[model samples]
Target: AIRCTPPDALRALTRRQVDTAELYYIRGDVEKACELAAAAWPEPAGAEPPVRRRALALYTHTLLYTQGPAAAQKLVDDTLAQAADDPWLRSLALAFAADFNSAGDRPYARRIAVEAIKICDELGDRADPIAAAVAPMALAEIDMFGGRGLDRSLIERARAAQSGQSWIPFIDRAEVHLGLSAKHVDDLGTSQAILTRTLRQAQDVGESSAMLILQAHLAYTELLSGRPEAARAALAAFDAAAREAGPGIGEPGSLTVSRALLAIMDDDLDRAEAILLAALERLPPIPIVRVVMDTPLGAIALLRGDVERAITLLAGVLEQARAVHVNEPSVRGRPEGDLGQALVTAGRLTEAAGVADELAEIGARLERPTLTGIALRVRGLIATARGELDEAEKLLGAAAQAHAASPMPVERGRSLLALGQVQRRRKAKTEARRTLQEALDCFTAHGHRPLARLAEAELARGQRAGAGSVLTASEQRVADLVADGFTNREVAARLSMSVRTVESHVASVFRKLQVRSRTELAARFKQ
Candidate 1:
């Protein structure tokens, strides 16, 4: 109909094309939507202000997913230049800029979002409704991405502006931001409830895109709240829904991170590695996505007993996260703690000490018990490595106590395990057994198989004789070789013994050292 219309009548038909493009976007046909939106106003400078604004909004949004952020950013820049005198169009352009920048340049995003809101405020009753609604939402999104506590005033303003707009996408986005803000504050219960409820609303309205993103958010919240089974279920549901919806409907980075975390919990390190590596190839160069994905890869390296590799991976992630000012406890905290552990394992105590201090400062600044607990645990590990058993015991105990204030079962279990090891080293047999049992119960209930196995080994060690009394010189040699990544056959060859004899010695060393696997053996050797 547009092409058949007279050239002079084309202006009247443009709104129809923009509306159709929006419908396409809502229906998940993003490429088609981009095509239509782009066709509607090929030259923004020549089109009417209102038509150009609508075309730019739809085109840039669709372009973001189809052609990447750079293309969308270019369009937004052009629109901003063209709309300098038009407060409404300028505010919308700023809002778009703020939303995309939240993924990368968070501080800048926050600044511009505030500026957009100021423009709307000055315009007052004359401000465009969409611009008014989106400006505050963009600021709230930047706050969410930065892991700063959400400003309820901004959220309320966005919600109020959205009233009577009938813009389903922005409405759903506001709700998601609210849900994730609860998560940022570690209010997992509220986050889960809001996300679940919002997801149902989206589903009821056939909002497929919102539903997929909400599923990812809910799964991440479940994982953090120590409900791995529920997290797994949510992820499975997301995958099934995405498959049915074809493609371009889900948030790839978030879904990838969540799935990789689940795999890590299940001890499927290879699967997690593959998932993250694949995502690295295809995922955009967004700072937050890179940080989240690489942190888990560092964890996988750490789990494999590659101390140097883990240190290198985690250190890079920590540096990038700091560069972006990623103060979120989960994003920066996890990698920082892991890097400290890796440094300690690699015998870099000074660097590990610096990491511990940084964590403590971050914890105090954020007022998050979880970060405080992690800092204590890292400090305790450093103390243990330095052979200060009393300090290790004290720190680990405090770490466990700090974690008890939060609902982080995995972190609490880790502190208990570390404390039990310190107690055993101090020859507090009864206390060590009790602590180990508690750690075991926590890991078992959370289905953390890897950590549960470590706790079980610690318990078994408490039941046996001391390491010095049980292991002979030959067994010690075999143990040292195995912990150094030498196979039993290689150890036997190096020691001029039979493979069977080496195997027997290895078993004795494992029993005496109270370790269940080579990774544990390596950790014991490092300590």
Candidate 2:
């Protein structure tokens, strides 16, 4: 379906029935698409390079969705053997085949995609859209996996060939839609619409495997939109469809992971945890599984007040995610947010602030509203811990607004609670009380008892009976400066206080904050 002539236009040519079939296939008509392809060159025994490669591409794609990676790999290997001179086909086969594997294998997929891109770049725009599509799909996956470097140009160029409309472009476009939806929770409606349309088109064409994959994503998007019931329904539909399609319809680890995620959303923590552990047992080693599973597990644990356990798991997963470059635009920024919470629990305020900054950057780049809100909430916590009450209040308020705009239930609840805590600390008693009550309502609505209890505590804090306020304004200011990597002399010079006075303030701030060492003080700032 590369940027070639339309099927009808190509039908006018005497020996291009295969081309016409390819056109139909690219447009989402897999059966008719395959038929056209078969009719174009009745036999591959004595076919030329174009017909052989075309047939191999069609058959390979068919096997991928219907059989499994092994079958598809055989076809790909045979095609490569036959088309040894063609780097383009080889690249496509390599990348497309890797899609059936884990995210740990993403680097392999990315490599193939890059190879395709390199070939295309060398060939110039004269290259067909068929070859062009592979590069962008690869880049998108790479960006989604790595959490950085989304090449919009590659995506746009790959889709430039409407005349050669085929299932590949549609599949690639659907992938983009899912990726964008996962990354950006701000506009759930638009993203969901795109996924819906893509799934429909894939189904209409007998692309059952593609349809199943899209269905999983659709369910994920629904869950992200704060509709766990809808997500459950969608997952059921996907499971049913996959089962009807028989074995090999769904990839090995994919459906399993989706089910686990759904379980987490349902608050079936035991089931969710078991599912993840089982997945780890069966699936190939991959950073995505660890990162994805740990984030939710940590969230669930945190909600359950298993703070120390949550911190340990999340911190470990965050390191794994970073090791594998999992912060990409398509994967969502949940890992960083999860890690920030872990840091907060451990009272590593400065570290948590850095993680929050990372989350903010990820959200902005990916257009993710929910993630941005969570990052803002964490920033508010960091600010409050550092005694910047006004800034903390402002950030917390922004978090509330951002959460309100998205459909992520957990994030919304957390934002509300964090905002309430900041407001209470700022001495806005009535507002704090109201906000904490609202947060409690949200947590209760979601059936999150632990979070509801925490919110209640914040509400009580708004009317606290503390015997003393330990850190004075000057001391807090000096603490903030020191935590920001400023020396005592620098803090004194900037604040117009003597070095000795600055040191005295720092010591008092440390005692009042119940921390020891500059590292601990820095950690508080991050929280």
Candidates in order have lDDT scores of 0.77, 0.63
Q: What is the lDDT of residue 119 in candidate 1?
A: 95
TM-score of 1: 0.85
Q: What's the true lDDT of residue 473 in model 2?
A: 49
All candidates: TM-score:
0.85, 0.68
Root-mean-square deviation of Cα positions for candidate 1 versus the true structure, in angstroms: 6.0
Top-TM-score structure, candidate number: 1
Cα lDDT of model 2 by residue, 35-94, tens digit: 555454335444565555566557666555455467766766666676567665665565
Q: The CA-based lDDT of model 2 is what?
A: 0.63
How many pairs of residues in model 2 come into backbone collision? 18
lDDT of 1 by residue, 169-288 (tens): 723366666886777665778889989998888777776666787888888888888899999999888987788778765565767887888888888889999999999887767766
